[model samples]
Target chain A: MHDAVLRIAGLRTQFRTRQGTVDAVSDVSFDVRRGETVALVGESGSGKSVTALSVLQLLESTGSIADGSIVFDGRELVGLSEKEMRDVRGREISMIFQDPSTCLDPVFTIEDQLVEALTIHGTARSDARGRALELLRMVRMPDPETRLNAYPHELSGGQRQRAMIATALALDPQLIIADEPTTALDVTVQAQILDLIRTLQAETGAAVLFVTHDLGVVAEIADRVVVMYAGRVVEQGSVFQVLKDPRNPYTAALLASMPGAVAGTGQRLTPIEGVVPSLLDMPSGCRFAPRCPHAWDRCHEADPPLAAFDLNRESRCWLEVDGAVDGVGTAEVVG
Target chain B: MTTVAEQPDAGPTGGTVDGPVLEVEHLTKHFPIRTGLLQRTVGHVRAVDDVSFHIDRGETLALVGESGCGKTTTGRVVLRLIDPTSGTVRFDGQDLAEVDADELRGLRQRMQIIFQDPYSSLDPRMSTADIVGEGLAIHGMASGQAQLDRVTDLLEKVGLSARDLRKFPHQFSGGQRQRIGVARALATNPELIICDEAVSALDVSVQAQVLNLLKDLQTELGISYLFITHDLNVVRYIADRVAVMYLGQIVELAETEQLFTDPRHPYTRSLLSSVPIIDPELARATVRTPLEGDVPSPSSPPSGCRFHNRCPQAVERCRHYAPVLVDLNDGRQARECPEYRPEPFGLTAQSYRESELLNQGTEAGE
Candidate 1:
């Protein structure tokens, strides 16, 4: 296997609510190899975003990494001081968010934001402006020279995203964490941004951890995928293994539910028949037991560990545990 | 160019006329921009500029476009929630503009609208019964025990139960709240419903449930939906016909399958190509002809063709002459651009090829 740029094991992120504490992410593990893109895919309430935020230590005040080891570039980051983590954030790791409108300050110009990202990381002020302009050009921002002086509102949604990407790449960090970066933009503009990101990542040879709810976007960009259900990794494999022949019932059901997956119109989508369990009152056994179609009696009574079913492939299901791969096949047939 | 006068009158002008459930002709809705202390009209934002379409009984005609393309305005104008600056809307053989206040109120019983955000669309403090029964109360259709029973029935139809009648909007999940919104829209027994991005906010699994519910309702109730959204995948699944809108105009109108398999307009082709294919091999193999620049501002839109600035096939002549919707005689219509040509194979064919590759991969793995 290629050297891992970032390795996370047994990550547990929790938030304090008025009622009690809730585990937003629990016992999640993944690794992003050098110069490859790994996608964390799930629907809302699935903790994909929480996992991304936990990696960057950017969780809200009510949330914290209760347990985990986030080792990036051979260094542990679970309990780093704020001052030390700040030094590691922009220089070695950078992050992009879904909505650029909220991420970029409305009062600052694009040039000011990019330059600040560089200067705060100890780049000389004299060299920052030139590097900022180059970064904008690298992101393919139209009229980069004029766009530098424009505020966040002055740019379109797509352009604002480009500016955000420019800022994220200002330091040429070794790792980039993008959480639904193209989700807010229009489809045509999203195509442009995806192309730009793929090109730039190739040029820089940087590892990427992409978080998104859309499987279509994951198919377009990711090399490996980790499917999350509720607050745990239900499946992890290469994009083809996970998408085409999913061994996990949750992943298979998710693919079957997409409107685009069916061939023709008038075909009823195979919808998973229940809502996600509430975090405050989670089920005792499998997190997806209530909604899983192939779940048996044992599935409702015991929590399945994430066990390796094939080389570099893992599935969290009693079907894999009991050597009942035919159960997953039956689920696919029903789906 | 065929002007509004030259076009056939699809509207209901006389008695016993058999026409579409809703017909909008030359619809133009422009919001004037006021400036300075004078508050004078300086310019106009052409939100819905000379758009036209119709929804037949039990049919869905999706109006699709990116943000700021005036699709939402078109939906509102069709229902007369916002008055059009020009042109006419005819519903069930009666001109909306010609109806008096009393007559319009009576006519509104057969039309309803469902919004995108269930959180904001439903009244927070109102219980599910009150929210669903508001139309019955307003129209004097039912009252007391009868109204409660009807609300219960509507709830059951939308996959909710009678137990939810006492719950408020905040008590339900996003999907359940949307189901309540659907029940409220169905409460009036409306023949036509304008669903503006109704399923856009839900998760994929929940979205599938809602989409299936909408399809089932159409089958059972024979209701026509003017479904407005930018998601083409949803459009393909739900809409019978689709009208692709650009900067305040209909650029292409065709049957859903025809539009997907053989798009005639450059803008439509690019838009279809831009949607990410769910198959990894297909997504990588497809070469996208992406539109270059951002959409031009609606207030100061580009001259001639609104899409020419970003169109990959734009020529010098496209910079001078505005295009009109040209009927293709097979129930398909595309804007008259110099570069309009029919391709034998498109994105759908590309998808088929990739699926073939996937089947081979599966066999090899076995």
Candidate 2:
């Protein structure tokens, strides 16, 4: 296999709120190949965003990556100094944020921002504008000449996203992390933006680690899927294996709960049953145990480790530890 | 009769009564684009143009499209929140456009809207009780002890506790605030609701709860829903029939099952294909026929099919002649498109397409 561009091993991040520490992400890990798309999907508060931030060492002051390692280009990122990490960021590993409306600087022209990124990354003054224009075209933005002078606010929503992606790709980074990049875009524009991301990745051979709650977008471009729940990866596999035959109860419930997947439900959705446990008051066992329909005594007594789920997948469930294919067993019904 | 149980699970064919509770005929809303310091109208944005659909009592009719596709505009016009430039809106037996301001104010209780963003919709300064009870106070339905009772009842009905009444909107989560929004809408005891992306702002888990709540409320109260959303999943879950919109017009309208299983419109097919499935294998394998270009501005739409710019199967006819919304005789339809009739799959059906469409009508009903 080609060397993974960014590999996270046993990563964990926690937020220290007023009441207590919230395990926003625990024992989470994944990798991005040179030109592949890896989607991290989960409901809100599932720690998907925190994990992304942890990779970049961009977590808020109150948030901390409590454990594990982030290996970028075979370098250990966990112990890097803030200043050193900053140098690597945006040049070697960059991110495109969720809201296209606010991500760009309102005062800066698209040219100014892209050139600044280029200049900071050590491009010569004469080459900055040429490089910026090239990056814009790389993202498939139309009318590159006029668009370069436009401020983010003057550009349309899709234009702004294309600009954002251009800025991220300015450094020719190895991995580009996108957090709900299409959430603010309309469906048509969303289609356009996702296509732009895929096309750019194709031409540049850059790995994309995408974070989103909307599975619809995930299914469109993701080569691998990682399902998060309450700060832990409940299931991880190839998009086909996980989405077609979800091995975890949480994954199944989430699939069944979607209104579009099934024609119509004769019975109510087996919707995980309760709210996510507040991070301040993390549960003793599986954080999802309270709402999990298959939770048994083992689930509530001890936290399960991420183990062999399917041949290619891994799930943090004790019930599936023995590699059961039916996605159900006696231990699955315990608790 | 097309009953769900008695029949072979045909969608929306029914033992239940079907008649218009809400009828919109040729509705149009044009927002003028003002430019320069003079603020002169340079052009008009046809946010909703000659759109027509009828929501039968107790049924959920979804207006679905990409954002800015005019679904939200149509939802607002149906409630008369924004005055339509021209159209006839008949609610029950009354003509809504003809009603005076005073009479329209009285009718607000019969029609309500749940906004997309719960955070912005409710007043941050107001407590939950006041927000939900505001409708009751406006209609003079109740006050003081009665107002408190009404608000409290509304809270429980939306699956929220009465204790949450003292909390402000910012104090609540996105999903909780949406529940409060739903509670506020129900305070009027409205028979018809315009749900404008009500569940889009919520998490998947919380969305399920809210959808179930809407379903339970629908069955119990016999309320009709004009559900507006871009999320196909939620539409499939709640809608009885759906209208697929693009560039301020409905391209197709039909029962939900037929729309998903056998879509006639190319745009409709693309929309269904865009919906993400949970299984990764299917996600990878499913060939997505994604729309290629951005939706043109409403102020400057395309000459022919608005979707023609991005549609994968555009021919010369699609560029010159604007398709008109026409029925296919079968249960499903394309609101516009010359290829309105459904030909059979075989070579013989291709020879007599109109006859094939007529022949399919019985199969659709059965």
Candidate 3:
């Protein structure tokens, strides 16, 4: 039996905004297996970030988990009190936020902050400082001694991010939830950070829930990809299956729209025509129906369930139900 | 011709009838760091130093680099949005630096700029009609019904409706606002548009729409573009020629395909290797030539080659001898990194071809 670090099923997260109840995440189900990196990929308003926040029970007061269950390491996380959840957080599960500039406390030095993380989680007080140094070196922060004494503002963007990762690993949490960790950094620095994360994950064997919008980064680090669109899971599969031969039209459209070296020059990008539907005024049947090129009469009647075709492969689309996989293979041959 | 007298050298852009639409020579802009409350000059931050590139008529030349590499600053300097400490900006066979006030005002109509952030670039208080039509009115190209008609035409050209004229910036989505920005840049019927990370802020789907619109507009109007961005994928799609910047200098320049397939400069090679390939199989199979450490501060750039600090193939000569940009054969050029050799890094032709076939397979299904 595989060791699953986190298993979330039928999760529904809602925010009571002034306009109405915004269903940020609805009917999402996935799992993060131990020592595996699963990427939650989506664009803005896709609820990928909200799903991460919900997993950690770190949603704002205005938002709450309305349905489903988030089970972590054989323990239920839903309905846990803030104080009880706080104990579970950072001890068993840690989070690395998107913006490293704002994530760390501006007033505190790197050493003080990391020491606090170690000491708060029950490491003896005397050893916290030494542990902080070790953590800094682990992330390969150059001149760790000097960096430990400096504030977050003193470090560069890449350095600050490495410090953030070190802090996330301070407690040796079983799972790390990172939300667009390298989105703010330059491409060169982004590559380094991704490599660092991969190396550390291997050394520590911690399951990683990486949330990002960049499909390239997803391909680089993710073993499995969970594609979310407008608060719903559109596709879930191994990276190779989804990227090479996508079953869902939305996923295919996203892959097509991305400018790649293969497309080169003089290629008209296959853009999805419409904007993401608003949560308050969502479309009747499928939210992406208006934009999906293959959307048909069946698609306009009801939303498709996430159907499994192969092991660890599922796509939520009417075409998949109608046996379009063979048609795609034939189309490729004709080309 | 009159502008040439002030700069002395006259530069490449002056009195050349068949020259490129834009010619920039030895451009350098150093921001002085004032310190000690006396506001005395402490040191210089060499944001853009000795940078030079040109955009041909009806062509797009992309200036690409990481953040703080002076690509954006070069764009602003070419447009004269920021005054260069020393350089020559020649537009349409005339020097821009020595143009008189009246002549400069007239020259402004020929050059326009598009910013990266659509949210902040447009004034929230101004209606779309005023924003797009403001340039038309200022340049005195059209007025009254003609200006309104022109604004409507421009808006329609960019995929927005005439009904959107009355709406404010806040009312439009990010993509729509970017379209408005594009319309405003087109209001003056400019020969050259400086796009500084223009499509970087949009979503992938929206980015494609904007990119297609840009391509279509270029074909229709024959407008040249100084497309500045860090995204290589977009560069490969839109740019004809690309100049890669590092610290404050141009490290490499080449035709888009030439640069992508065979980058000679170590920095350019490292950058290309670092870009995460979309294909999971290809990405996993490739072994990247990792660049070491962060970019050095431009204010205190390393002696000789700025990239020497991070270059894996750096030799003893790279640390002392600052190499000049040298022209290679076949319309390709690179800064002389003497220690650098063309070693194939990341994603061989076989892997690239496989990924391309896979991508085509996805498209064939469509």
True contacts kept of 2: 0.52
lDDT of 1 by residue, B1-366 (tens): 112222121221122445788889999999999999999999999999999888898899999999889999999998889999999999987899999998887778778999999999999989999999998788777778878888888899999999999999999999999999999988877878899999999999999999999998999887889999999988988999999999899999999989988998888999999998888877888888877767778898888777767776554455567778888788898887655431212223334233222112121100
lDDT tens digits by residue: candidate 3, A191-300: 98999999999999999999999999998999999999999999999987877777778888888788872356455676667688889988888778988887888888
Q: Candidate 3 docking: what grade? A: acceptable
- Top-down DockQ ranking: 1, 2, 3
Question: With candidate 3 superimposed using the best TM-score fit, by how many Å does residue B132's alpha carbon deviate from the native?
Answer: 0.7
- The model with the greatest TM-score is 1
Question: Model 3 segments beyond 4 Å from truth?
Answer: A324-335, B1-16, B340-366
Error of model 2, residue A221, in angstroms: 2.4
**DockQ, computed on Cα atoms, for candidate 1:** 0.41
Candidate 2: tens digits of C-alpha lDDT, residues B1-366: 122112221112221334688899999999999999999999999899889989888889999998678999998888888899998888875789888988887677778899989989999999998999898788777778777876887788877887898989998877788889888888777778899999888877788888888888889877889999988877877899999988888899999878877899878987776665544445556676665546677888877777666666554345556777877788765855545432222223234333323212121100
* TM-score of model 1 (CA atoms): 0.93
Enumerate the chain B TM-scores of all models. Answer: 0.88, 0.86, 0.88
Tens-digit per-residue lDDT, B5-85, candidate 3: 122211121323667898999999999999997899999999999998888988999999998899998988888888999
Q: Report the lDDT tens digits of candidate 2 across residue range A1-335.
A: 55688889898887788877867888888777778899999988889999998989998999988889999999999989999999889999999987765568899999999999999989997999999999887887777889999988877777888899999999999999999998888765677688778888888899999999876677677988899988888889877666666777777777766654553544455455667776777788877788888788988998888886445688887677745446742111100
Tell me model 1's lDDT, rounded to 2 decimals: 0.86
Error of 3 at A103 (Å): 2.4
